[model samples]
Target: MTHDHDHDHHDNDLDPMAARVRALETILTRKGLVDAAAIDAIVETYETKVGPRNGAHVVVKAWSDPAFADWLRRDATAAIASLGYAGRQGEHMQAVFNTAETHNLVVCTLCSCYPWSVLGLPPVWYKAPPYRSRAVLDPRGVLAEFGLVLPEGQKVRVWDSTAELRYLVIPMQPEGTEGWSEDRLAKLVSRDSMIGTAVALAPEAA
Candidate 1:
């Protein structure tokens, strides 16, 4: 459940959205409008059971099997569903592939409509207004902020996620992974890669 991202400080600090959610839960529980235990169970499910690991599995499979990659590109919802990763926030899915000439980025311009079924709870930064607006207005700048500097000629294409549909970025396979197994490849797939803020890890890095 641990991640190596620079935002590890978030683990120590109470996320702003989480603080708001807790306040709302308190109000709802006090008014008897919501079950506190039920809410806790749901949170536990996402925190423990559903997470980036699920999305990594999908990414690794696509990397190892070209046919699966084609199917994911054609019918992401069904292809992802076939892997048992379909649920709320991931009903309608679209897979965008990262290639040598183009990089893909995902953002929910209106709100944080993320693929919770695959990637678990949305990160606090993902729901921030700055990321939402800038991702659409200046994707290259946003990637730079994430420390991902794309090639000069590589185009950045941003996808806006909606309530009805969500997007997953298929990062290009890294080099020196010619015959890597799916399990090993999955280790190289990070949550940011699927979100397109980063790319798959290099073999040595993994």
Candidate 2:
């Protein structure tokens, strides 16, 4: 059941599972039961199986080890596999660096293209047409809107994602974490950092 597509255009073909989702939605809407339970089941499908928990492991590992973080920022796919969270879209991910010099941003132009292996199903706002259109055009403004105003000297590089290689942001380590172990450090890393909203914080700082 592992069907690999050789041609890029082949991806556009109807995924039977997705077609089934549409069919189910149509049935539910017709039956007047597109309620909270239906949504919950759909959310569970992605959260438990298709979304980004795998990618989160990479973020946690990177947060703990400076060397591993460096390796990850250089080649995320391999670095993640080094720690064993390699599968699905993450198999070909390219970690984008958001630093004092260049800040990276991710948005799915056509849809909410995200690194679900680590981050989980994108929040509703991420798929909103407004965020998709505006985040790319005005990244600084968007970040500010999200209450993430960088210092005046930093540069920003907003990256729009295609279906082929997903992206994740590696937030900078917080201060006061001088001699923390990787396990302790991992706890400080949050999904927000991977999704590029908040930065990571050390325990003492937190």
**CA lDDT, every model vs. true structure:** 0.90, 0.73
Regions of model 2 farther than 4 Å from truth: 1-45, 49-56, 89-91, 202-205
Q: In model 1, which range of ten residues has the least summed lDDT?
A: 1-10
Error of 2 at 78 (Å): 1.8
**List of clashing residue pairs for candidate 1:** none
For model 2 the TM-score comes to 0.70
For model 2, how many clashes? 8
lDDT of 1 by residue, 62-119 (tens): 9888999999999999999999998764369998999999999999999899988789
Task: Report the C-alpha displacement of residue 96, candidate 1, in angstroms.
Answer: 0.7
* Predicted candidate 2 versus true structure: per-residue lDDT over 1-206, tens digit per residue: 56666765646666899999889988988899797576888678675765445555676667566798889878877887676555454347778766777666778889878776667778897899988999878878888888788888787776677777778887666777767776666667666666675667657755
